[model samples]
Target: MELLPFDEYVRSLDRKRMSAGVLFRDAEGRVLLVEPSYKAQWEIPGGSVDAGESPWAAASREVREELGIERVFTRLLVIDYVPDDGRMPEGIAFVFDGGLITNAEVAALELTDPEIVSAGLFFLDAVPSLKATLAARLAIALRAAQAGEPLLSENGTELT
Candidate 1:
């Protein structure tokens, strides 16, 4: 039997999509969510990770692009592995801790990206209005952030 060339072997492996998001909270503990112009369900500030971009960089870039604010997130809150749904491919999502933003910072946010229509802080209970998977992911991520520990989840359910 002959082994495939290194490059050929690499290309044969399945490629999974990746996305990174930043979980920002207010002093009152409400999570910041963005309403995308193309989607009815609101989500956190984030988007797909570029091919060559690190998850941290992707999260920071998404925040800056969507909210027009520069924030460096150093702590990762949750890593979720989502299965492929009919609309999207299977992927891994990284949620970073944006800590707490002040009221002034919230007021100063500019929706620089046309894709994002609005931004607001919402209580955890209200996040259920988002896609079910995303809502579960955010709830776990928020808990992980508050607990000062990172969590692992699959399809929005926490892994033991």
Candidate 2:
């Protein structure tokens, strides 16, 4: 048997894409969702984790980059494993607790040009009407938020 260098061995494995998003709420408990110019469906404030970036950091970075607001992630909400759907590779999606933003904070949110079209605060119950995959993830996130524990889900269904 032959062995390759540690770095070489690590590089030989298949890599999955990682994305992080933040779940924001208002005093009325409305979920904050953003409309991305690039996508047909609405999305939360987040993006793909860059190389060597932690998921938590990615969530914070995405919020700043996408919304032009600085938010500190309080805790992890949900971790979703999405299978490849013949278009993109398999991926792990993370939703972080964005904490409640005041009306002033919400008003101050600035959308990134050409990336974010607008932002809206919707009731948690309305999340299911969004994109299928996103709705699934947010459902898990809302549950995790209420329970104060992170959830493990596969495409939105909680894994026992």
Candidate 3:
């Protein structure tokens, strides 16, 4: 095979999109979910990972931007691979543990971002209302967090 130039070889590689999110929970076991102005469904605090940014950094930045709070996340809960479903390109999503937020902290949350309308705590049963893939990924993530382990998922299904 003919050798391709370095630039040509790099350009020939497929690029996959990535996103990162933070999972915050309350002492009562309710999870923090944010409602976005652009979407009807509620979501975790996170956004797309920009070019050249690490997933952990993206998660922290997204939390600060979306919730107007500075949070340090140290544990990864899940890495989910979302398959292309026509509307969106296939991408990888990283979910980090945001630890537990106290009731006072939850009450003090103020969303200043135009993208996010509101943020609130909800029980796990409410998770089913989320998008199918997200629901699946979150289920596994929660389990992993409770078990003090990280998990891998594909389209929301846990891989053995």
By summed lDDT, which 10 consecutive residues of candidate 3 come out lowest?
124-133
lDDT of 2 at 96: 96
Better of 2 and 3 by TM-score: 3
Cα lDDT listed for each candidate: 0.90, 0.85, 0.88
Candidate 2 per-residue lDDT over residues 1-160, each given as its tens digit:
9999999999999899999999988878788988887868888889899999999999988888888877678599999998998998999999999887776777787775678888888875675347777877887888898899999999878887
List the candidates' TM-scores in order: 0.92, 0.87, 0.92
Q: Give every collision pair in model 1.
A: none
What's the count of clashing pairs in each model shown?
0, 0, 0
Give Cα distance to truth, residue 5, candidate 1, Å: 3.6
Error of 1 at 151 (Å): 0.4
Model 2 CA deviation exceeding 4 Å by range: 1-8, 102-104, 124-129
Q: 112-146, model 3: which lDDT tens digit per residue?
A: 89998878888867753577677777788888889
> What tens digits encode model 1's per-residue C-alpha lDDT throughout 45-140?
999999999999999999999998787877999999999999899999999999888767777888879999888888877763588888889889
lDDT for position 12 in model 1: 100
